[model samples]
Target: MDTIFYNVMMKSLRNGKQWEVLEELAMEMIEKGIQLDNVSYSTIITCAKRCNFFDKAIEWFERMYRTGLMPDEVTYSAILDVYAKLGKTEEVLSLYDRARADGWEPDAVTFSVLGKMYGEIGDYDGIQYVLQEMRGIGIKPNLIVYNTLLEAMGKAGKPGLARSLFDEMIRSGLQPNVITLTALIKIYGKARWARDAFELWEEIKSNNWPVDFILYNTLLSMCADLGREEEAEKLFDDMKKSELCKPDSWSYTAMLNIYCNGGEVEKAHELFREMLGSGNKLNVMSFTCLIQCYGRAKRFDDVVEVFNIMVERGVRPDDRLCGCLLSVLTFSKNGEFGSVLICLEKANRRLVHFIDILDKEEATLDMVKEKFREILNESVVEVRRPYCNCLIDICCNRGLTKRAHELLYLGNLFGLYSNLNTKTEMEWSLNLRSLSVGAAFTAFEEWLRALIEGIEHNERLPTCFAIHTGVGGRKLSQGLADSLSLHLKKMGSPFQQSEERAGWFVAAREEVVLWVRSLDSKSLLATA
Candidate 1:
C-alpha cells in the first residue's frame, strides 16, 4: 500500500483509540518503503500523545525533522505539549523558538500548555513572557491562560501582580469564575492580606457564586492563619449548610486550628469530637493545634491526654508537633516535666536526651551544643527556629544564663540567626527583634563586649548606634523590650529609647565610646 493508504488507516485507528494497531501499521509502512510525509508523521505523533507514548512521539517528531519536513501548527503544538509533559523544558523552548521562526502562530491551546509548564517549575518570568508573546502576536488570553497565570502568581507570592492580572481579566470582558476568585483568595492569604481576602469572599457570597470544597478549605485555612475566628465560624456553618459540598478532614482541621489559635479551647474540643464522630481521620496538625492551645492555657494534664490520644490513633508526631511539646516543657512545672519528656521521647528521643543533659551538672556547654546540633540536623528546616527558641527559653527559666548564651551563639554559628549585628557606614545596629528575652540579654552583652574590643583596637565606630527590640505584635516580645530597657537604665548605659522608633534604643557614638572606656576591668570581666 502507498503512504496515503497507510496514513488513512492510521488516522482511523488513532480516532478509534486503537493505539497499538496504529503503531503496528506505522512500522509496516516504514518496512514497506512507504516514504512517510508530514501528514503520516503528524497522525502517529498525535496517536502517541493520546496514548501517553511520549517517547514514541518524540521519536517520530525527530524522524519527521530529519526528513526535512517541518511540522504544521497542530503537530508543533502537540509535540510542545509532549515535551512539556516529559519535563523537557530545554527541548520545549528550542522547538517553540523554531516554530515561531517558521511563522507558526501559537493558538490558545499552545499558550495554555506553555503557561502550565512554566507554572509547574515556578518560572514566573517565563509565564509572563508567554503572556506578552501571546499579546504581541494579537492573540488575546482566554480563561485557561488567565487562570494558569493567576495560580502561578499566587504560588510565587506576587499578590500585587495577581491582583492586576485578575482586574485585567475582568476589564477584558472575561467573566471571573470560581477558579479565578480562588486563586486571588490564595494569593491574599499567602501575603497575609486578610482584609482583601475577606472582602473578595464577601463578594463571592453576595453574588451567590459557586464554591467548592477546595475553595472553602482555602478560605478556612486563611482564617486559621489570620485568627479570624468569627469569620471561620460563619464560613464553617455555610459549608455545613451547602448541599453541593460538605466539610472533609481538611475543613475540620482548619476550623480546629482557628478555634485553637483563638484560645477557644472548649469550642475546639467540641469540633474535635464532631470530627471524630463524623469519622474524619485525625492528623498531626489537628493534634498539634490542640496541644498548643492547651499549652498556652497552661492545661498541662490536658496536653498530656491529647498527646497520648494522638499516639494511640497511630498519627506519628512530626517535627512541628515535637517542637510544640518542647515548648510546653518550658512552661511546665518540675513535676510535669517528666510526663512531657516521656511523650517527647516518643516523638524525638534526642530532644529528651538534650533535656537530660541540661539537668546534668557535669554536662559541659560543648556536650549540650553537640546534642542540640544533632537534634537540629534531624529536624526539618521549618522547626529549627522554634526548637532553638524553646531550648533557650528552657535554659533561661532554669537560671542557666551561661548555657542559654552559648546555645544562642551556637544558633548563630549554625546560620539560624542572621544579622544579629550589622554595621553600616552611618550606623551600627543590633537587631534582637526575633530573640527571646534571655537570648536578647546575652546578645546585648556580647554586642557591648565587641564594641569594647573594637575601641581597644582603635577600629572606627559609626557615628550612631541602635539596638532594636521588637515590641509590637507579640506580648512576649514586649516583655523582652521592657526588660532590655530596664537593664540599660540599671547599667547607666548611654543608649536611650528612640521617641521616633517604637522598638529602637539609639545611642550617640561619643557617649557610647566614653561609657565603654570608663568601664573598669571588673565590669568588663563580668560581661566576659
Candidate 2:
C-alpha cells in the first residue's frame, strides 16, 4: 500500500495533477498476484505520454522489460505521436530503427506520420520513395498518404506526372470521388492548362457524374483563358446559385482575375472580399495570384500590402515567395573502401590466429577454447581460401606428432609403420602399396630372428633340430646325400671369393656355416 502511494504520486507528477491518498489505497487493494500484462503496461506508457511525462514513460517501458512484460502497438504509437508534435523527428526515426533490430514492426500509423512530415517539407521525391516502399511491401496507401501526395505534387506543378497515379488508383478499383476530382482540377487550373482539366470534366459529364463547384470553377477559368468570358460568367452564376454547390475559392480566384484584367479594380477587390469571406481563407497561392495581378496592373502599393499579409498569416513564402526584397545567397565517403579493407584486415588476422593454434601442441580444455575462438574468428574472416589452408596445415602437423616417440611405437604396435614417406607413397601409388605390405612382413621376420638369437646367446635353450626331428610323426636321422656337393660349393667360396665380394645375402649366410661343417666320409664314397 505504501509503494502504491508512491506510484500514484509519480503519476500525479507526470500528469501535472494531484492524486488522492485513498485512490492509491484502492489501487493497491486491487493489485493481484499476477504481475502485469502487456496491455496494462502499454496503457501506462501511453497514459504517461498523454500526461506529457516522456521520461517517465521511457522509464516505465524499461521497467516493463525488467518485469518481463512486452509493450504493444498502441504504446509505441502514442510515443511516436508525441515525438512528431515536439518536432523531434530524428529521435522518432532513430527509435524506429532500434525497434527493427528488436523485431518489432511499426504499423501504418507510423508510416503515415512519416508521410505527413515528408509532405510538409515539400520532398516530392520523398513521397515517391515512401510510396515505392509501401507498395513493394503490399501496403495499401490510405486516404491521408494518397491525398497528401496529390496536394503536394499538385502544388509543386507536377499534375502531368500525377496523372499516372490516378490511373493506378482507378486500377486499384477505387472510385475518384468529388474530393479527388477537385484536387485534380485545381492542379490543372493552377498550371492554366485546360487539356486534362477540361478532359476530366467532360469525362465526368459524359459518364453522368455529379459535377461539383470545383468542376465548374475550373471550367470557367478555362473559358476566360480562351476568351469565352461570357461563358465564364454564365457558369460562375450558375454554380453560385445552385442548391447543391456554390462557388468557392477556385471560382472567386478565377472571376476576380477576369474582372481585374478589364480594369474593373473595384469589382475585383469586392470579389476578393467575397471570396475570403466565403470560407476561402486565402493560402499563399491565393496571395501569389493577387500579387501577380497587381504587378501586371502596375499597383505597387497593393503588391506590397498583399506580400506583407502573406508573411503575417505565417504563410512565409515558399520557393515562390520572394518578390523584389528578394533574395539571399546560400552555399562514408569512401565507405565501400573502408568496409572492404576492414574485412580484409580481419581475415588476415584470423589466418595468423589459426597458424598460432596449429603451432601450440599442448592439449587441455584450453585447446578446446582456442578451437572455438578460431571458429568464431573464421566466422568474422569472410574469406574461405586462407582459412582452408590454415586448417589443412593444422590437421597434417598434428597428425605427424602426438607425444615423444609415440608415433613410432604406436605405428609398430598397429603394424602400420607411421612413417610419413610410407603413408604418402602408399596413398599415392599401387606399386608402393605392394612394397608397404612386403616391408611389414620383412620387419616381422627380422624381429622373430632377433628374439631367437637373443635367447640362444644366453645359452638358456637348446637347438631342437639335431636332438629330435620328425618325418611325418617318426624320428629320423640327418640326410647325407649332398654333403660333398655342399663342401665343394663352400670351398668354391674360395674360388669365387672375388664373386663372393658381390652381394648375395652377403653369400656367406650359408658359406661360413657350411665351411665349418665336417665332410662325412660315408657321404663322399656314396657320391663317388
Candidate 3:
C-alpha cells in the first residue's frame, strides 16, 4: 500500500498536480488510520519543494517530526535544499547542528548543498568547514561538490582559490567536467586574463575532452570582448565542422556580434542568413547587432530596413534598439547638412510606414509626430530613458521644438529614466562627424536667420507634450515636467553650451538666433 501511494504521488508531482493529490491522499490515510511512513513524508516534502510551495514543505516537515518519524538522508537533503534556496542560512546551520547532535552523519548530497549555500553567501570559511566536517565523517567529496565550490570561488572573485581547487580535484584522481571548465573560463574572461583562458582551452583539447557547444560559445564571447575576431571565426568554424557538437542560437548570436563589432558587416550578414536558414529563432539581440552594424557604416537605409523586418516579424523593439534608431536618425559624423537632412527625411518616412502598419486610429499626427508617438509608447515597446534623451536632442536639432517638448511630456508620463549615460551614446558621438556641402554662414545675420528658422515654432511645453500616464507609465513627482520645459526653453540662448551638450546644440550658431529660438513662444518675446 505504501509503494502504491508513493508511485501515485510521484505521477501526480510529474503532472504538476502534486499538491491536490497529496491533500487527497493525506485525508484518505488519516480516515483509515494508516500510519504514514518515512518514505511517505519524504515524498510529500520533496514534492512541496519541487512545486515551490516552501511554506507547505516546512509544514509537512514539522508534521513528519511531530509524528515521531526521524528524517532519513533524502528527507534531510530535501529540507536543506529548500533552506538554501530561501537563503535561510541560519535555519540550515540549526539543522546541521541538530543532525550532528542526534548522531546522524551528513551524506554527500547534504554537504554539497551546504557548500553551495555557503558559496552563495560568500561564506568561504563556512564552505571550508563543511568540507572538513564531510572528511571528518569519512564521506569523500564528489565531482558535484567540487564543481559547486569552484563556481562559488569564481563568483567570489577568488580565481586563485578556484585554480587551487581544480588542481586539488585533479590530484585526487577526479577529472574536471565541462561545468568546471566553463566556470573557470568565465572567471578568466571577466578578468581579461587571455593567457589563462587559452591555456585552459588548449588543455581541454589536448586531454581529448568533448568540446561541446557551451565551451565554444564561452570562448567565442571572450574573443568578442577582447576584439579577437579572427580567433572567434576559427572557433565558430570548428563548431560547425565538429560532428559531435552542433551550434545553437547562442553560438550564431555570438559570432554575429563579433563580426559586427569588428566592422565586418558583410560577414555578419552572411552568418545572419545562416542562422535564419538553420531554423533557429532569432532574438532581439540578433536584430540589434545588425542595426548597429549598418549604423556604423552610415547606412541609415539598411538600419531602417532591418528595423522594419524586426517589427514585422512581431519582435518588439526594446529600449536598446530605440537608442540605436535614434542615433542613426540624428547624428551624422560628416557635417554635410544636405546628407543629414536627406537621411533624416528617409528615416522619418520609414518610421511613418511603421506607424501605418500598426494602424491605430488614436495616433492622429503627421509623419514626424506619429513616428515619435510610436517610439515612446510603452504598450508597444518599453523605450528606455537614454533613448528618450537622444530623441529629444534629435527633435531639437531638427528644429522640432514642439516635438522636443512633446518628448519631455512623454518622459513625464513614462517617468524620466535616470543614469542617462550608456555605451550607445559614446558610439554615436565617436563615429558621427560633419559632412560638408552647404554654404558657410560667413555673416552673423545669415547664421542667426538659419538658427531661428530651425527653432521658429513657439509651442507651449505642457499643452503639446502631455501624454496620458496610464497604468504602464511610470508616475513621476510634481514639477519635473516644468523643470524639463525650462531647460529646453533655455537651449536657444547664445550662452547655451552646445559643445558640452553634444546631443542637443550641435548645428545652431549666432547669439541672436540662439536667444530668439530659445523663447517659449515667438509671441512671448514679441509681447516682452
Candidate 4:
C-alpha cells in the first residue's frame, strides 16, 4: 500500500502538482494511521521541493525525525540539490554538515553537487578532495563525477592534467563525454596549444561521438584566438553539414571576430551583413568585436558609423565603449580638433562625479622660470604665482624637467593650463618653512629610502623630475619623492665634509627636521 501511494505521489510530482499531492497524502496518513518511515517523509519532501516550497520540506523533514525515521544519504542529496540550484551555497553546505553530523554519509549525487559548486569558483582542489573522500568511503564514482572533475581541471588551465584524468577514466572503464572534450579544446586554445586542441578534436570525431553545438562553438572561438582561420572555417562548414546541429549566432560571431582580427575587416562586415538576413541579433559583444576591428585599421570614422548603427538598433553604448572611443580619438593622428575638444568637454562633464569644482584647476601653471626659481629660492608656489611650478615639477620628473620647466613658464605667458593651480591650495605645503639647503637634503633622503624599501618589497614608486621638484615645493609635500627616487640618484650625499662641518650640518638638519615633522604625510601625498 505504501508502494502504491509512493507511485501515486511520484506521478503528481512528474505532473507538477506536488503541493496538492502532499495535502492528499497528509490526510490519508492521518485517517488511515499508516506507519510513517523515512521513505514516506522523504517522498513528501521531494514533492515540496518540486514546487520550491523549501519551508514545507524542512517542516516535514523535522516531522520525519520526530517519528523516529532518520534521513538517509539520498534524502540529504535531494535537499542539497535544491539549495545549490537556488545559489544558496552557504545553506547547501550547512545542510551537508547537518546530515553528516547526524551520521549520514553523502552519496554520489551529493559529491556531484559539491564538486560543481567549487568548480564554479576555480576550486579544482575541492573536486579532488570530494573524489578522494568518495573513494576512501568505498563508493566508486559514476561518469558524471569524473567528467565534471576533468572539465574543472581543464577550465582551470590544467589541460594536460585533465587529459591524464581522461585516460584514467578510460582505464577505469568509463568514457569521457562531449563536455569533457570541449573543455579540453578551450584549455588548449587558451594556452595557444593548438596542436593539443587539434589532436583532441580529431579524437572526438574518430570516436563517432555525438557532439553538441556548444562543443563546436568552443572550438570555433578557440580557433579564432589561435589565429587558425583556415581550421575555423573548415569547422564552420562541417557544422553546417552536420544534420544534428544548426549554426548559432555565437558560431557566426566567432568567425567574424577571427576575420576582423586577422586584418580582414571587410570580410567580417560582409559576414555580419549575411548573418542579419538569417535572422540573428548581433549581441553587444559581437558588435564590439567589429568596432575594435575598425579601430585597429585606423578607420576611426567607420567606428563612429558603426556606433550610430548600434544606436539605431536600440543598443545603448556602455561606459567602457565611451571611454575606449575617447582614448582612440586622443591617439588619432589627424583627429578633428573640434571633435576632440567636444569629447574632452563631455568627458569633463562626466568627471563631475569624481571631481570637486576645485580639482579642474589641476592643469594650470603661469610662472616664468625667473619667477619659478625665485619661488624655489623662496620655497613656495606663492599667492597668485603661476601654476608653472607644478607642471615643471611633474614633467621634469619624467626626464623632461628642463623642457617641462620651460613649458610651464611659456604656458604661464600664454595662459594655457594657468587656471589649474588656482582652484585649491594644498593644506600640507601651506605653512611649511622656507626651502633651506638642509630641508632639501632631508626630503631627498626620504625619497631614496622609499625607493630602497620599494625595491626590497618588489613594489614601485613613480620617479620623475616634475615629481621630485613638485614635492620639493612648500605647498604640496611629494615633489621631491618623485624626482630622486625614480631618477638614478641625481641628488648626492655630502659624505666628503669634514668633522668641523659636522656640527653645522647637524644643527641645520635639526631645524629642517622640525619643519617637516610638523607636516601630515597623508595630506602631503593626497595633494601631491
Candidate 1 structure quality by residue, lDDT tens digits, 1-528: 588888899999999888889989988888988889889999999999999999999999998989889788789889999999999999999999988898788888898888888878878898888888888899998998899888878776679888888889878998878788888898999898989898888888887777899899999988877778888888999888989778888999999888776678899888987987888788899899888878877888888999998989999999999999988887787777888888899889888888778778899878888888888899899999778888888888787776777788889989888999999989999998877666777788788888888898899889999999875432333676788889999888898989998889999999999988887745764644
| Model 4 quality (TM-score) | 0.57
The most accurate candidate by lDDT is 1
Models ranked on lDDT: 1, 3, 4, 2
Per-residue lDDT of model 2, residues 31-106, tens digit only? 7443445655555666667667677667667777677544576766676666656667677677666665676666
For candidate 2, the 10 contiguous residues with the lowest summed lDDT are 324-333
Q: Tell me model 3's lDDT, rounded to 2 decimals.
A: 0.63
- Per candidate, the number of residue pairs that clash is 0, 0, 10, 23
Tell me which of candidates 3 and 4 scores higher on lDDT: 3
Each prediction's TM-score versus the true structure: 0.83, 0.39, 0.65, 0.57
Give stretches of model 3 more than 4 Å off: 1-17, 119-126, 273-281, 305-319, 332-383, 396-528
What pairs collide in candidate 1? none
Scored by CA lDDT, what does every candidate get? 0.86, 0.49, 0.63, 0.58
lDDT digits (tens) for residues 1-528 of candidate 4: 865675566556636755876657665775787766666667777777777887777777777777777788767777776776666777877777777788887777788877777666677777677777788788777888776776667656677777787777778887667776776677777777888788888887898766898999999988877678889888989988989776788988899778876868788878777776767676666666776677656676666667666667776555444444433343344434244324334433432221122123343333233433442333233412223333333233334433443443454454432222111222111111222222233333343344344444654322211111222211123433333233323322221212442211111323333433444545433322
Instruction: Give candidate 1's whole-model lDDT.
Output: 0.86
CA error at residue 416 for candidate 2, angstroms: 99
Instruction: For candidate 3, report its TM-score.
Output: 0.65
> Which runs in model 1 stand beyond 4 Å of their true positions?
1-60, 78-94, 117-128, 155-157, 171-173, 263-270, 364-366, 468-505, 514-528
